[model samples]
Every structure is written in C-alpha cells, then in structure tokens.
Target: MLTRTRMLAVLLSGLCWTQGAWAQGSPTGPAVVATIKPLQFIAQAILDGEGSVSALIEGSDSPHHFNLSPNDRLRIEQADVLLWIDPKFEVYLAALFADTAASESSLMVTASAISGLTLHRYPDGELDPHLWLSQGNALLIAQALTEQLACIYPDKAPHFRAGLDQFRSGIDKQAQALQRRFSNQHVADYLVYHDAYRYFEHDYGLTHSASLVADPDIQPGMREVLELRETISASSPACILLEPDASPALVNTMVQNDAVKRITIDLLGNSLESSANAYRQLIDHVATGFLSCLNI
Candidate 1:
C-alpha cells in the first residue's frame, strides 16, 4: 500500500520522464513543395538545410500541359508550404488552389505577391505568367518566399534571409554577365516555337521577330505555319528557337533549307539537376543558345 505522498511523487516522476523523452525527439523542419522546377530551385536555395525542397512537376513536360498525379496531390496536401505561379500560369492547379485558398492552408504564393514585376498582357487581355525569366523578378520571388518561410519558422528567419541574400547576389552577377555577353552581339532577328520568351526578350533587350505557335499544347494551324514561313523567308531570322524536347522533324521543316540557325532553349530547366545554382544554369543555357544562333 503506497502512501498519498509516495503516489504523488510517483506520478510526478513519470510525468517528468515522459516529457524528457519527448524533448529528446528531434524536431523536423516543414515539408515545402513547389509546383515546378524553377520554384523548387529557389526554395532549395533558401531552405538548404532547414528543410527538404521538392518539385511536383519534372522533366520536359510543360507546366501548361502537366496533369497532376495522385502522388502530387498527396504531396501538396502534406506540404507545410506550397508555392506556385499564378493559377493562370498553371490552369490545372486552379481547382486545388481554390480549395486550398478556401481552407486553412492558404500557403500558396504567387507572382502577384512579389513586388517589382513587369506584367505582360496579350492583345486578348490575358496576362503572361512567365515572369520567372527575369532576374529582377527572381529577387522579388526570393524576398516573398523568405518572408513566408520566416513566418512559418520564426526561429529560422535569419537562416532564410541569409540564403535569400546569397541567391540575390549570385543571380545578380549572372544576369549582369549575361547582359554583357549579349551586348556585343548585334541585335538579330529570331523566331520561336511559342510566345513564352517575351519576358526574357524584354529583360535582355532582344527581339523575337516571329513565332510559329502561340500555344505549345495546341498545334499551329496551316495558315499560321505558312505565315511564319513567309515571315522567315522575308526576314531571314538569324535563328529559330525551339524548346528542349521539340521534334527535330518539325524544326527542320520550319527552317527547310533556308540555311538559318536552329537552337534549343529550355525554359523549364528540365535538363539540369535541380539545385541552388539550377536557376542560374537555366539562364546561362538560354544565353548560350541565343548567342549560338544569333552569332551565326
């Protein structure tokens, strides 16, 4: 038979022991998920050691054509923070965004949340969502992401800020170097398979005189193709730019003995492994592609 004081002491001892074990358990950072590779690269740079960063969409699949898998849905649902471009950029994510925006997990960050962005509008009044191509926009994105991450992990705010600063410094130098590289080349006429690089052209002061298709998912009409052919015949653009995985047959047919240069530029960074410098590598690759074609 235990005395009252003994029973109280035993209860207190067990409580303390349980708490000690609980405290011994390691703490984990949040699970962060970005919708695309570029976003993942930015997040990985900022989160580095704080938490793991992952992208839901990968490979050569354009974000415009990506169909979310069950695993992707699960990843989004489980994420402590979910980041993506505007719903207009990723139309497939519109429904999931609606649900999440309505629920408690409104952690989705968009370009609108970032400052100092130059938004592009089409003749039909649709906003271009490829703002990530601009290095300035990348800085704004890092700032917005760092702020959100700090809110989620207040204790780690300094860490996130430091990462962001490093990213800004690195990207700034890369952008400047790219500008210098392009500055020496005489402005040249170019053609593209899609209208996705307007932001890049705008940022770098280059011109894409013609585009075969307005949308990547939709096949260009014969009229549009013929118009592009005529434009190329008339202008004799220095280069025809295609996406990384674009069909060589179609590309060859478009240029068709015109003796024009053909180069592939990857907007999605699909060929490079995702890392802190992946964004820079993507920009560098684009610069190299442009220089190769334009110099010819």
Candidate 2:
C-alpha cells in the first residue's frame, strides 16, 4: 500500500505538472508552501480561492527529523510564501532555510513571537515548538497566514479577512466547548506515548503523568522505560494517549499488562482533507479522543 505521504507526493506532482503547463501562458498568484499538513491546512484556509497550498513533508513522518528531497526543496524555492512552526520543531528545516535563498520568503511563527500564548520550555531551556496544539496558537496561525496571503494578493485582502473572521468565530466556540468538556472531567493525570501534547494539556488544565518518549524519533532507554513503567504501575492512569502516526508496538510495550485504556490522537490532521475547517475538525477529533478515554 502506498503511504499517505507517497500518495500525496504523486498527486501533488501531477497537479504541479498540470499547473506548470497552465502557468506558462497565464498569470497566477504566488504558490504557498507549508512545512507540514497542519500548516498547509491553515494556509489553505486563508488562500481558499486565491491560490493553492502545498506541504513539503506529508504522511506519518515526524517533522523533527524529516529529510527534504530535491522536489521538496524546489517547492520551497518556488513558494511565494513559506510557513513553518519553527526550527526547534522541524530541526532539519533550519539549515535548509539558511542554505536556500528563500529566507526572505519564509516566516517562523514561534511561541515567543505570538502574543497571548502560554509557552513551555524543556528542561534544557528550549522552547516547545508545538504551538499549534493550543487553540490560541491556532488562531494566531490563521491570523499570521491571513496576513501573508493578504500581502501576496492584496486584491484579495477582503476575502482573506472574511475567511479569517469566520475561522476565528468557529474556533472560539469550539475552544470554549473543548475547555468545558475537559474541565468537567475528573481525570487530571494521564500518560502519553510522546510528549507532544503539553501545549494542549497546558491550555486545558490537564496533567500528564508520564510519557514514553520525549522525542518521537528517540526511543526510550531501558532505564527511562522502567521509570515510565513504574510511574504507570503506581498511578494506574485512567487513560494513555498515543499518536496515530507512531508505532502501536511502542504503546503496547509500555502498557504491557496494565489495565489502562488507550486512545489515539492525531495532532497533525494527517487523515483530514485540507480545507478551511480542517483545523477545527482536527481539534474536535483530538477532543473526542480525550473524552472517549476519560469517559466524560
């Protein structure tokens, strides 16, 4: 079976070929490129009828360690506006940005740059780059991308602004509802396969007891595994969250004989079709996972 990433690559390649042929004789808006699916989804929302958006890395691969191909690099160079979370999250993109002449076209929306965000830092004092996990950050993403699109196609500023306002309204209601849903639940502590939900947790006032891996690409050492095992055994958390893109074997090995319930959460919206409401659906999907796991 072709993975989603490969499938998207083939589809986008075909589309690019078709679009390239058409562009030879027609005037078109600048191409928008994003580093991942979530960013692509947000960009798509703002660009709707104005232009198309493409993602460099697709499928289940973690952005933390993705290796860009020649085509991917070409997309970046050709993009009129490039959006990514930050180099801390997509570490490989940092060098790519520096090496390529596309620096002037790229925007890094880190937590610090965005106002009204509750940022977190790792023990090493590095900022958490998972800003998209929080609803507030999602709003920030939509606003930032709207500004980019407006600049690129100033004639469509009204369209972009209207879309941004609609998105803001929809997400505001959903965020309030999600907060109510999680707040009503009594399960304050839970376990996760990866430490990717701290932003969400912080936003919702949920507490994570332990994580199987701090970095998705790095497996837990034996000592760390034992510690997590002990923590789970001691707390017997009501729910253990796993990333849909991660290996189920890792979650199984961690849980072993524990009676805890397991739930899969997809933060990247990989399974969702890109649209204006894709981010909202992604948030709802994650909320459903938490609600199902907590039985609230």
Candidate 3:
C-alpha cells in the first residue's frame, strides 16, 4: 500500500496536469494568504523568495474571536491560494467558505483535510484543530503547499521544491536536537492554562498534569478553579504553562508556592517576525519555555 504522502504526491501530479499550464513569473507571483500566523510561517518557508505570504489574523488576536472585516474578505477572495487549519479552529472563516465560491477553488487547501495528518481529539471527541503543533504534521503541510504552488507557477517549481527540502531538513535537525535534550531529563509534572498543547506535549514526551480549561476562550469557573487548585496541591506541578496573554493573577490565585514556576509559551508565534525560519523558531521557543521551568 502506498503511504499517504506518496498518494498525495500522485494526486497533486494529476492536478498539475489537469489544471494545464499557468502563466508564470509576474512581478510578485501569486498572492498566498493563510488564516493564521503559524500557517503563514509554513507557507513562508515553502514559498521562500518565490512569492508573498500573509496571515489574515496577526499579532495577539485569537482566532476564536476574530471578526472578518470587508478588507479581510476581499483579501481572501483575491488570493490565489488560501491555507488554513480547519473550519472548527477558525470558526470565523467557516461560514465564508461554506457560502462562497472560494470553497470550489482548487487553490484552497485546508490542512485538516490533508492526508496522513496525526489528528488528535478533545476528551469529548471534538477534532483538535491545533495539528500544526506537531513537527511531523508541519512537514506534511509544507509538502501539500509546495505541490500546490508548483502547479500554479511551473516556472518556480524548482525554487518551491528546494524550499520544501530545506524546510524538512531544518525541522528534522531541530526535532532531533530537542529529542536529545529531553531524553537526558526526567519528565516533570506541569499544568497548562488550557489544553492547547496536546500535540506538542505528545510529540516531546511531555504531559500536563491538568489544564485549567479546555477552551482558551472560556475562563475557568469557580468550581473548575477549585478543582485545579486541589490538583495543584496534590501534584505540586513543577511548572504552570501559561499563554502569552493569560493572566498571571489567576495562576497566582491557584498556586501559592513560589517554587512552582510560571512560564509563558506562545504557540502562535506572535512576537516573531515572518520568515522562512519562523516555524523552527516557534518550535525552539516552545521547547525552551518548557525546559526553563523544569527542576533540572
């Protein structure tokens, strides 16, 4: 049986042939848009200098509450290729794609729909849309993007393939280094502000003792907070991983022990500039944040 990656490569090759030749090499190439920063980072790496890539949601904006303005809608409509995680992750874009002709476009690539992704689920069994947190998933996403871009710009196919090779090499090297670093240390108990890092934690052999809330958009109620406090008291977690914008006051209220370190991990890469290396940097930042709070 063919691997999913091999199957996807075959499908993409057929797409390139059926779509026919595209006019290549305009001033800036195609306008590629990603719904969020992390997706944008992957596209940036694959596009390299071959094209432009931008995110619809930037800075500290949470996709859960992001509102699409008229300008944002126009950008999506005008984009040659649009990449996003899933409809469930970016609920704002779900309706637009559902109602508009954009859904029919061959250029629209939803990462969730991509083959061979190791998707996770919440305890209640809802699809976990944070698939990009895994380096393996990121490589698969890059492969899909590279094939799609190559189809659009046959002239730039070599550059896009080269970009994909470079991205895979960088990610593999970084993952190996992280695995080595983590192998030497004993697993430390930790708590998370929310259950956003399941993919990351699973990838690096780390696990959180408890999560204050399942949804980042929802704050923990009194009952949930009390329970979390009890768990903290019982486990004495080495660290409590907080989101970049998470309130330290809440953690302070739950944790009175000074030895319990608080570390802010930005899964969205909000502070980093857009570059080919941005995805790798994001992974490194997350790993360093975890290592810092460890007892070692």
Candidate 4:
C-alpha cells in the first residue's frame, strides 16, 4: 500500500500530464495579416474569434506608396495567412510575394483573383482593386477566406462556415436597409475627387458626373481644372465628393459655387475601430455621406 504523501504526489503528476496533453492537442488557429484595414475587416468577420487578424497598412497610409519596414516584413513572414488586393494596387507587396521563399510557408490570398467577384477596370484599362466596396464582392471574399482558413485549420471549419453565413446575412440586411433608404430619397448627381467609388456607386445605382483626377497623386492641371469648373458650373451637381485627405484648396478652385455641397467620404475606414462589423459600418458610412450631400 502506498503512503498518503506518495499517493497525493502520484495523483498530482497524472493531473499535470493530462493538462499538458490537453494543451498540446488543443487547436489554435492561424494568425492572419491583411494588407489594408478594409481587407482586415472582411477577414475579421470570417475569422470571428477563431484566429487573429491584423492590418499591415493602418491609418491614412495609401498602399500605392506604402513601403514595408523590418517589423512589417517580420509580421508578414510570421503570419500563417496573408491577404491583399492585388499587385497592381498594392504595388509595394508585389515583389515581396514573388519570392518563393517568402510565400512558401504561408497562404497568400490575392483577393482580386478570387473567382465569383465582379471586378471592374479604370478608364485607363487598369484593374480596379477596390472590390470590397461592393457588398456582393465582400461576400465572395468572405467565402474564399472561409475556404482558405478551413484548409489550414480543418477543425475550425464549422466555425468559419458559420462566420461566413453570419457575414452574408449581415450584408444582405444592411444592403436591404440601404436600398430602402435610397428608394425613399432623391440622390442627385455628384462628382468625386477620384474614381475610386465605382463599385459603391454601381451597387447603389449612383453615378458621378465627373472626377477631379483619375489618380489622387496626380493633381489636375490648369486646363483640366478649368474644364472641371465649367462642368460643375454647367451641370450644377448636388455635391462634390472629396476624400478625407483631399486638398481643400483644389476643391475650392473646382467649386467656386457655394451652392455645390462638399462631403468627405472615407472609403478607407480610417475612423473606425477594428471589429467584425467594421466592413458593414464602412459601407453604411459611405452611403450616409452620399445621402447627406446628394439629398440636397
């Protein structure tokens, strides 16, 4: 027969061993990293607490000119899954992903290449990578994310599927609400600082009369400015949609008429906190901005 102290020690050892085994067997999901906040928002919805999601480009930084730092590189290297729009838009990430060594260990998702998404092109024939603006495209993205994540962590496939369903339902509800809101009001013609809202506008049946510039980095010249001003004066558009970072002076130059309203549309979700519903909030906020200006 064992002594009381010996029996107690043996029981404690067995308990510790069992705990260790359980810990080792527990399923811990992947660490996903997105190239931008909008992508991160979509990923967060699908991940839905099954894993971690983070954005590489935060705040007002434009991916067009974003350069990765040592920390950023480390984050990408350590991530189990990486998400980005495409090489054309996120030009900085193209070369990094091209390296076989860099891409070998992780799942890299080029959202633009995902099938079932309705993609668009710029007037210059370049692919428009802002597909997330459309709730439909967002659904497709969520589905793709679910499938990719499921492949990596099959044990959490059910949770990911549930997340995708929830995301689709949330988008459908929000889109219906927005459609009702727009149907009850008159949305007048508008102009945008750049042609970035094509997906949003197409989804809502709203069209801009003109744009100040094709690319935000390239400011309109004197002739282009005069033409835009003439167009604004002639058509009397209800509003001029300026981005959060648009130049006030340029806007003033383009819109000398005080009757033309100016509304700041943040497509980047700059002011939003990171959450599962952030993508929906972004769409709602954008619609609200348009309604505030276009309703006259």
Candidate 5:
C-alpha cells in the first residue's frame, strides 16, 4: 500500500504526464530545464550535442532550502522540459509546477514518481529523500530522465537514446568498479550524522548506523544520546560520518571519544558544484569515503 505522501506524488506525476499526453507542443529545438544540478548534468550528458539543457539550481547548495535567484526564475520560464525530484522536498518547485501545469513549454519528472524509487523512514517515521546517494538508484533515475527526454523530443530520440545507452553502460562499469574496490574491505557498518545513504549502503552490502533520523533537525534527548553512546561503544565502528552542516552534538560525541575514525561526507557535492556535479562522481565519492575509513 502506498503512503499518503507517495499517493499524492503519484497523482501529481499523473497530472505531469497527462498534461503532456493531451498537449504536445511543436517546439523545434529542445531547451530542457532541470530543477537540481545532478538532474541537469544527467540530462545534458544524455542530450550531448543534441539539445540545450541547463539547471536552475547550479550552486552547491541544498535544493531543499533553495531560493530562486533571478537566473533561476528566468531559466524556469524558458525551459521546455523540466526535470525535478519530488516537490515535497522543495516548496518553490511544487508551487512552480502547479502554476506551469497549463503551460506548453514545461515538463517535470519527479524521482518519487518512478518505479524502484525506494522510500525509507526512521523508526520514528521521518522520510529520507537522498536517493541519489546510491549508485544503483542513480542509474534508475538517469534512465527515467533520459527516456522522458527522448519521448518529449522525438526529433532527437535516436541521439538521446544512444547517449543514454553509453551513459548507462559507463555507470554500470563504475558500479562494478565500486563493488570490486570495496568487496574485500568490508566496511559494512558506519555511523552517519543523518539517516541518509541506505540506498548506497544497501547496494554495497554496508550497514548504516545513523546517529540522527533527520539531519540538522534531529533533537535527541539525554536518554537517546546516552543510548547512542552505548551503541557506539559496543560497535566501535571504523568511522563516524559527519556533514559540515548537520549535527554538531553527534560529531562532538565522536571527537570527545577519540575511539573511531572521522570522515566528512557531503550529500550536496561537498557543498560545491564541481565535486558533486554528476551521479557517477557522487557514488564514487561515497564508496571512496567508506573505503577510506577502512584504511583500504
């Protein structure tokens, strides 16, 4: 059974595709607009030399807290095919999609709208939207975006599909490389400041013992903190993970203990545009972070 959030996502995605089915625009050239940087990168890579693709959020900033700059608004208005993740994570995107539903030059693809988009929650019921952290899920996302682009711009369908095939193949090779690289190291269990990266950990058979269910927002009382301390003491995990902006308390715990390794992993490309500009590099960074902790 789908949860209410998922059900709403399904309804919104239906509306997204239904608008296209009913009204196919006759634009000559393709100018795709993506909501996030990673989505933009994948679309551009697929339409390499075939179309014009760009992103509204090109900064190494959190899309969850993204404010539309003047350039962002301009790009959104000019985009022909807009690809984005679930708007539940981005309020501006949700409102923008609602307003542009009647427009002919706009299309939005949400990651939560597709199959194989795994939804996870903490034991307390908070959602994790960081699906792009895992290489496997990233491949699925890339495939969906490529297919949608091909469908919308059939004039370049052949070119798009060929590029997609190559990209997917390359991604597969990278996945294999990740697996082989970490197979013997066996850094299965690591502590995270936030409850993200299940997809990446699951793909690599690693265990994510997250310190917080929700990042930056996690409010653990004294009891929870004490319990977490015990868990860390027992596990003695090879590394403790922290994000630059997440949980100061949890990170301080590790620093105080001096019992585990410390690794800073960034979900938003290290809060920089270059390191996390693509899916493959993001996955690589995660895998490398894990292996680096194991002293592998």
Candidate 6:
C-alpha cells in the first residue's frame, strides 16, 4: 500500500495549496507532513519553519471517513516525516506506511504507540483513535514528534528539543490553569451527542456516556434512542454536548427531556473561532465549554 503511495508520489503533496506550491518540493530541511489538521497544527507549533511542515488532510473533514486521493498518496511519498494517529482511525495510512517502510523511511510517528493511553472501544472493541482530545496524550504526542524530528533532522536537534520542551511546559501550564479554574466542579460524567471525548475523559478524569448513534454517519435507531433517553434521565448530565455537524434532532430530543440542556460543542473552527492558535487552545476550549455549561 505504501508502495502504491510511493508510486503515487507522482501526484501532489496533499496540502491544499496553490498549484505552484505543490509543484515546489522542499528546498531545505525535512519536509514534515501529517495526515490530519490537528497533527499538522501540533507539528507546526513545535517545528517552526517556512513551509517546512505540511498537512495532508483538509480542514473540516473527518479523517475517519477519508478516502485517499492521488494528492494524499503523493504527500505521503514526498514527506520526509509523516505523523498520524493510530491506524484504527486512518486505517489506510498503516497499510501505506507499512508497504513503503523499507524504501520510504518516512520517519513516521504513531500517536497511539505512546504509553498510558486510555481506550475508548466501540461495541466491537476497537481502539478509538482520536487521541488529540486529551491534554496528556497531546503532550505525549508532542514529545514523540520532537524525538522523531530529532532523528530525522539531527542538525536541528537542539532547536527542536528546545521547542519541544517549551511545548511540554506550555501544556502543563494550560492543564494547571484549567485545573485551577475547574477544580470545584465535580464533572464526573456528561453525555456527548456522539463518541468523540474518550481521550478528553481519560486525560481529565471525566466520565462520558454518549447517546450512541447507530452509525457515526447515520442517525440513532428507535432502540438506541430509547436507551439514550434512559441514560440521560438517569445520569442527568449537565448539558448535552452537540457538535455542529451532529444531528440537531437528537440533541433536541434529549434537551426537551427537561433533564438535560443543549450545549454547543464546537469541534471545528467556524464563524466563531478562527483557524486555531495552538494544540493547547483546543483543549482550553473544551475545558471552558464544559465548565461554563456545567457550572451553570
């Protein structure tokens, strides 16, 4: 599969750029590329450069449901380093990297390989691969990327290490700030309109039982709806966290129960928040949103 990606390198670097930028390969330093926006954002934060880091995934698109285009294949091939979450979410990426591991030597980093990660299994018992939500896991991710970047660009080891240390310290500060602000809140559990918070829950010691949809891309069935209603009634979650793309009807049903209120959980930057500042900013937003609603 990676061989095919390598073969397909004849396409374009997966980053959405002017046709001119895609045509121009790296002039200097390692060309760090990632499969998703969050990974790309983290890499950019730690590894400062002018077009040195690139993202293969587009904004506002879910990596779980991604289909590799010709451009995506090329981006993998051209990348000196490719960082991604576990193969579970981007299953195709594993096969791509595995096939070309010998030839490409892309110096890939797998986000889930880090120790102390908590599992969020589906009914079928598979690893939920959205590790970016947890502050601790994001730290682990930054550290791993820093180490990998050192290996790839040994000349930049000092710079990369310093940046990484700063990144780690920044993560700690944000976590502490959130702890200080939210310490009084005993938010043991909440109900998500979907299953995107396992990593967040694991990191902050929060428990979340989501109102399961029959399929991530589809609606919940009657039985699933009834079960969720029961969960909401019994749990009395502070608010029902609803993603922008999630079904409004499901949220409405739960909120109308009088046991829960509807709260917007902005997963992506919309008309409200802009492009995104740092990895920690996303975590801060999560903490702020939950705290604001829960404290209410």
- Which candidate leads the pack in TM-score? 3
How high is each candidate's TM-score? Answer: 0.86, 0.83, 0.90, 0.88, 0.80, 0.79
For every candidate in turn, the CA RMSD to the true structure comes to 11.4, 8.6, 4.2, 12.1, 4.7, 6.9
Best candidate per lDDT, number?
Answer: 3
Show the lowest summed lDDT stretch of 10 residues, model 4: 14-23
Q: Which whole-number lDDT from 0 to 100 does residue 224 have in model 1?
A: 70
Q: Which stretches of candidate 3 lie over 4 Å from their true place?
A: 1-14, 17-27, 99-106
What lDDT tens digits, residue by residue, belong to model 5 across residues 1-296? 22335334633443334344314544546777776666665676677766577766644566767787777777777666667777766667787765554463465567766677676666767556776766556666667766666556656668877877877887889888878876776454667877676777777777766564355654777787777777777776767777667666656753356757788777666443432236567666777777877676
Per-residue C-alpha lDDT of model 3 across residues 63-103, encoded as one tens digit per residue: 88898889988877766677888778888887675443223
What's model 6's overall lDDT? 0.64
Runs with alpha carbons beyond 4 Å of true place in candidate 5: 1-28, 58-60, 124-127, 247-250, 270-277
**lDDT score of residue 190 within candidate 2:** 77
Q: Residue-wise lDDT of candidate 2 within 26-145, one digit each (tens)?
A: 147747778888778777777776667887877777787687888888877766655777666777887766444223333333323544556888887888777777878777767766
Model 4, range 1-296, lDDT digits (tens) per residue?
A: 32324323432332221221122222556678899889999999988876688988888888888878898888777676678888788888877754522334555677887767899898678888888899999998788777767666667879889989999999999999888777655668788998988898888778889998878888879998998889889988888889988988898998888988889988889789878899999998898888888873
lDDT values, one for every candidate? 0.72, 0.70, 0.80, 0.78, 0.65, 0.64
lDDT of 1 by residue, 143-220 (tens): 777776666666787998999989999998888888787775677888887788878888888878877767666776
In model 5, state the lDDT of residue 287. 72
How high a TM-score does candidate 2 get? Answer: 0.83
Q: State each candidate's clash count.
A: 0, 0, 0, 0, 1, 0
